[model samples]
Target: MKKNLSISARLTLVMILLLAVIYPLLIAAVGKLTPGKGKGETISVNGKVVGYERIGQKFTADIYFQGRPSAVDYNAAGSAGSNKGPSNPGYLQLVQNRIDSFLAHNPGVTKEQIPSDLVTASGSGLDPHISPDAARIQIKRVASSRGISMQKVTELVQAHIVQPVFGPAYVHVLKLNVALDEIKH
Candidate 1:
């Protein structure tokens, strides 16, 4: 028993050193090779920093295209999902409320036309990208609110679609909103 205890203690010490120290160092080293070096990729406009590329922003105004409903209310400091399953009554009720709110803001848009991404919060609660379809669905409301033609709004949404190498296309909501502000007409 004495020998077994000694072995266990040594193994635990080795694991702690390996996982708690060395692993983090290795990850940081790898992160240095990526864009923003794992700190965050900032989106700037006219030399003013607006937001991070990976963190979503809340745009509730009718003139702006809203991003996903954030479980953390787009608070980067407290990123998380609702963690409620689909069958959970509270979760369903929350989604229903979101759908209703979206319809109220976007007149002439049917519930079926609204994409799920527009109504559901992402797992991270900080996803910056929304599906192209999600952005498209909002063009009508945004154009009307901004007094721009739907064609111009659609063109802007199409220009912002990012076809990543590994996943489906998505548009950065912050980028889109910034461009929307730049439109003189």
Candidate 2:
């Protein structure tokens, strides 16, 4: 029993060193090789950092296209999903509320036309990208609110679409909004 206890203690110490210390350092080193160099990628406008690249934020104004509803209220430090399954009553009600709110904001937008992404919070509440279709649906409202033509807003959304090598195309909400601001109305 003494020998077993000694072995367990040694194993625990080794795992703690590997997981707590070495793993974090290795991840940080790898992050340094990425775009933000261990920090998140920032989207800047006029030399001012407006927001991070892959972090979702609230955009409630009618002139701007809204992203997915966040379960964690877009709190980066508390990123999480609703954790309630689709069949759960409270979850259903929440989604229904989102649907109602979206329809209210987006006039002429039918419930069937609303994309699932727009009404449901993503698994990671920080999902910055939405499907191109989701952005397209909001074009009418944004164009009208901004006093721009729908064609122009459509073009802007098209320009922001990021086609990955594996998955379907997506638009980064923060980048799109920044670009929208840059457009001369």
Candidate 3:
């Protein structure tokens, strides 16, 4: 009976050790095989790397398009919404502040033309894309800055508007930036 009990204990210990070693190796192998968003490559301009799909950076220049609003100050590890419900007083205040800033920078734009994505932070603070309307709204400013015709800039924006890979939605910011870089050259 003692020998039988020792055998059972040894079997359990071996199983535990096997799991401890194999489980992590399996997980690591799967992680390596998985294709993570923004892990493939970054879009470069004139051999200068600009940004990654996972990060949201501020684009203040008039010659470039802007991305969606960020809540965690564009920190990837801290990605999250402001958690303010639509009715929250803080939400309204923040929206108003964002609107004010947008107007300040885009002095030529009217209130009705501002895109909703520009004034509201995305659920994930690291959104690297903006709505097509947002890109369109910035065309005048970008054209003026680059001294290009509005028609040319508009055509470029339309060309960069990426239709949803699977459906009807689209992403416009990355393509817009790439086009803007081309215009610079």
Candidate 4:
């Protein structure tokens, strides 16, 4: 029994050193090699940082492409979803409210045409990307609002499509909106 107790103590110490200490250091080292070097990737325009590319930003204006709904209101520090299931009344009501608001701003968009991503917050609540369908659905509104042709907006959305190996293409909404601002009508 005494030998077993000693073995457990040594195991615990090893685990603490490996997981608690080494693991975090390893992660930080890896982060240092990334684009932001531990900070998130920032999108800049005119030598000024507008927003992070990996985190969502709230863009309610018709002239900008909107991202996924965020339960935490785009607060990166408190990234989280609503934690409500699909059948829950509150969740359904929330989705309906989003749909209504989206339609109100997007004049001709139908309820069916609205992508699920636009009405439902992602699990992390900080998704900067949305389905290409979601971005395309808003092109008309954005084009009209910016006084640019729909063809140009379509080209922008097509240019930003990110095709992952396992799923359909998605567009980074923040990048799209930044490009929108750069376009001269």
Candidate 5:
């Protein structure tokens, strides 16, 4: 009976050890296999790596389209929202500040034309894509800065807009940057 109990105990210990080793390996493998914007390799242009899908960085040049506001400033490990409800006073203030900044940068734009994504933080605070409308709104500014026709800038935006892979949605920010690089060349 004692021998049988010892055997059972040994088996349990081995199983536990196996699980401990296998669990991490399984997790690592699954992480590698998972498909998402953040995990994929970033595309570069003109020997310059401008952005990453997982990190939100400022694209402030009038010649380039901008993306959404970030809460954690696009820190991947610190990804999170402001947690301020829409009605929160802090949220309102933050939005107002963004509007102010936008107006200061885009003197020719009307308040009605500014894209919502330009002032709003995405839920994850790490969103790399901006809405198509946001890209469109910046076309005039980009065109004026680059001395290109607005029509040409618009064409670039349309060409760069990533169509929905599985549904009717699109992303415009990264493509806009790539288009900007192309125009420069």
Candidate 6:
């Protein structure tokens, strides 16, 4: 019994060192190679740090493009989705309210033309990217609100499209808005 206990203790220590210490060190080393070195990647304009590229921000102004709906109210510390099922009455009403508000702000946009990402909170509620269709849908509103031409804003959105190696193209909402703000038009 003593011998078995000794071996078990030794194995436990070894496993803990290997899994907890070594594995985490390796992950940290890899993270160091990323853009932010384990910290969040920030987007800057003219040396001014605007926001992090990885976290979504709330943009209620009609002149700026909006990101996905956040159940946590753009509170990065409390990242979460609404967790309400599609069949839930409360969730349906919430989506309906978003749709109505979006329609009111965008006179020409129809309910069907609205992208799912525009009204639904993502699983993490921190997604900073939106589908191209989502950005395009708001182009008219943003252009008109900012007194910029639709063509220029559309070009900006097109320029910001990021095509992942395996997924559909998306535009980073914060980056797009920042770029839009910088444009002379």
Number of clashing pairs per prediction, in order: 0, 0, 0, 0, 0, 0
Candidate 5 versus the native: TM-score?
Answer: 0.75
Per-residue lDDT tens digits of candidate 5, residues 10-71? 99999987898888777777878676422665556666766665556667677778888888
Worst 10 residues of 1 by lDDT: 37-46
| TM-score-sorted candidate list, best first | 6, 4, 2, 1, 5, 3
User: Model 5 scores what on Cα lDDT?
Assistant: 0.76
TM-score of each: 0.82, 0.85, 0.75, 0.86, 0.75, 0.90
**What shift in Å separates residue 6 of candidate 1 from its native position after superposition?**
6.2
**Which residue runs does candidate 2 get wrong by more than 4 Å?**
1-23
Global lDDT of each candidate: 0.90, 0.89, 0.77, 0.88, 0.76, 0.91
lDDT of 3 by residue, 13-128 (tens): 99887898888777777777765432544666768877664566767677788877777877666779877798989799989998888787777888799878889988888777
**Ten-residue segment with the worst summed lDDT in candidate 3?**
34-43
Query: What is candidate 1's lDDT per residue for 1-185, written digit by digit as tens?
Result: 99999999999999999999999999999988989897878888889888987788998899998889888999898889988887999889989998998888888988888888888889989898899999999999999988989999999999999998999999999999999999963
- The runs of at least 3 residues in candidate 4 whose Cα sits more than 4 Å from the true structure, single-residue gaps closed, are 1-7
RMSD of 5: 4.3
Highest TM-score scorer: 6
User: Candidates 2 and 4: which is better by TM-score?
Assistant: 4
Tens-digit per-residue lDDT, 1-185, candidate 4:
99999999999999999999999999999999998999778889998998887788888777788888888888888888889887999889988998998889989889989888888888888888899899889989889988889999999999999998998789988898888788873
Full candidate order by lDDT, most accurate first: 6, 1, 2, 4, 3, 5
Model 2 CA lDDT for position 154: 94
> Ten consecutive residues with minimal summed lDDT in candidate 4?
176-185
The digit string of per-residue lDDT tens for model 2 on 116-158 reads: 9888888988898899989999999999988989998899999
